[model samples]
Target: MVKYLDTPGGFVTKAAASLTLDAGCEFGGGVDCGSQYFLGFMAYHRAWFLQDRLALTVGGGAITNPGRYLVLLPPINGTTAASGTPYFTANPGDRYRAWDFQVAADVIPRPFITFRVEFNHRAANVPYFSGPGGVTPPGGNQGAPGSLVDGWSPDLVKTENRLTGALMVKL
Candidate 1:
């Protein structure tokens, strides 16, 4: 289920959740059954002042995936969804969780243009975010896609903080 609310100078909220169930047999005819769940929620308030020319917003959200089947695996070593890497295996039933807080200010000089600056801080229970060294290998991608090279591993961290600016236009 999912829900969303949007109103300038008012409270906004959103929530989404999903579940997956799998029941089948493995290649060796062994029983394989499992269930995964994911839930997330976020809420924010947009306050408009100065004749509605400026606005401020603050919001936060959290997510939990008990069996991280829904989590996106980092593309280390030029890996892709179809070709997974061995450095960080995301098998079913693995735990992955994250939360984040954000604050943003927007300037709406005209009805069609908006400038925004936002700051965000996110954290995870496991090493999920990319680190300063990045996810690429030392000498770029080598060997087959998603395949490992000797003595090399991508950098991953548990926390991240960033500031971003964007210009939005609504035609």
Candidate 2:
């Protein structure tokens, strides 16, 4: 479960928790990318490959973005005078991205092994943090600030498509 909020327009933002665990093939540990909004359903990707070095290979997969999570916050309040509390606040009911498609490719090293490559494209969701203004929180009216408020927004959520490659050997 990932929970974060972007600032209004581009004022202040906060990303509290983004937890994920794959639990790989042998219960070792699958692939985990922390967490982030997908914009539309055409964001985020996950795949598998079995290759070596020579044999050419190709495959296809799909994508499903969780959606954008945005929020806005004021500065300093989690403390008293100079320092007291050291935690941030993230508004709820943030935006969520949609799901998209994914592509795959690979290079075979040996008959028994091969290499892999993948490319992913995520749609763009609304810019959560821009600079707080007429935009209101999802839950209707903007929530009230805590005793202390101190933070920054416009925190860019990076989902730049990536070029993946790999090398494998056969026994």
Candidate 3:
């Protein structure tokens, strides 16, 4: 969640990310769970031989849930079927791990402004991120409270690539 720039001769620059995952646990008739993981990288900015004042940063991060739990049910539910039953899922577990890498460039045109482009790759063993179809319910508002909507499965893929651009202004 934070970025660090090292001294010209400080040997390395540091970049880090924060990851969190929660696996529900059963207690009496209730369940509870949560997890957190992170990855970081160190780099030297003196390797940009093609461009002047262009900074390149490379980093990798991980996602993991090293908890003991099962399908997480609502802490409190007033449904007619049961009070602590969890929703249905074909594949449900309390453990998972994922990894990602990013390569970003900062084109510093001035002291107060910079144009940035980043390329990232992520790979996971479980369902993560939105696919061609997003996570939102289709067609919006299927019905009112307690009404069942048409069942639909999301397109959960294993690998994803993302390209992003940003215009940063620092005062």
Candidate 4:
């Protein structure tokens, strides 16, 4: 699953984190990949109707947040000791998610251009990754140490929700 932790338009990162939850100088030095901040997302679109002179377009999507249960938040939230190395938790994990939708209305004002206005509710597939790891056997709960690393998408982000209004010139 992926999680956000940045700006509003971007993924929700530790920056968007509630300052009150901060553990302070001793508690992981301001870290909060805290065990309660997981998320996910999905999106799709289509046209509803159109006039005799032009066609119309429409679409929407969702953010899937299973819930957050990370023992770590972000490196930026950490102090000097916090490096690429992640901190450990004493329990299992959880996930988080939220959703947003969108709609669009546009028309061919002339043969060469199509002017449109769009209204949309934007949300993202919160960019986070989680995969159980360790040398233990598949069914061994009491095996050696394991890990769940959280980081950005090595490739493209999962998805997003945003309102975009523009002119299409078919020249």
| Top candidate by lDDT | 1
Ranking by TM-score: 1, 3, 4, 2
Q: Show the lowest summed lDDT stretch of 10 residues, model 4.
A: 12-21
Question: In candidate 1, what are the lDDT values of residues 14-109, reduced to their tens digit?
Answer: 222333333332222231333356667666555655555677778777877765656788888888878888876766556777888888888889
- Per-model C-alpha lDDT, please? 0.72, 0.34, 0.49, 0.36
Model 3 weakest 10-residue run by lDDT:
71-80
Any runs in candidate 1 off by more than 4 Å, and if so which? 1-35
RMSD of each: 5.9, 18.7, 7.9, 17.4
lDDT of 2 by residue, 19-108 (tens): 232221111133223343222111222222331222222322223233112322323222233332223233122334322334655555
Q: What are the per-residue Cα lDDT tens digits for candidate 3 across 1-171?
A: 433433444333333344444333333323333242222323222223223346676766654543312223222112122332222221224455667888888877776887989999987665654577654456653344223445754445668899999999997
3 against 4, candidate with superior TM-score: 3
Give the RMSD in angstroms, all C-alphas superposed, for model 3: 7.9
- Give candidate 2 regions above 4 Å deviation: 1-91, 127-159, 169-171
Pick the TM-score winner: 1
Per-model TM values vs. the true structure: 0.76, 0.32, 0.56, 0.32
Q: Each candidate: how many clashes?
A: 0, 55, 0, 31
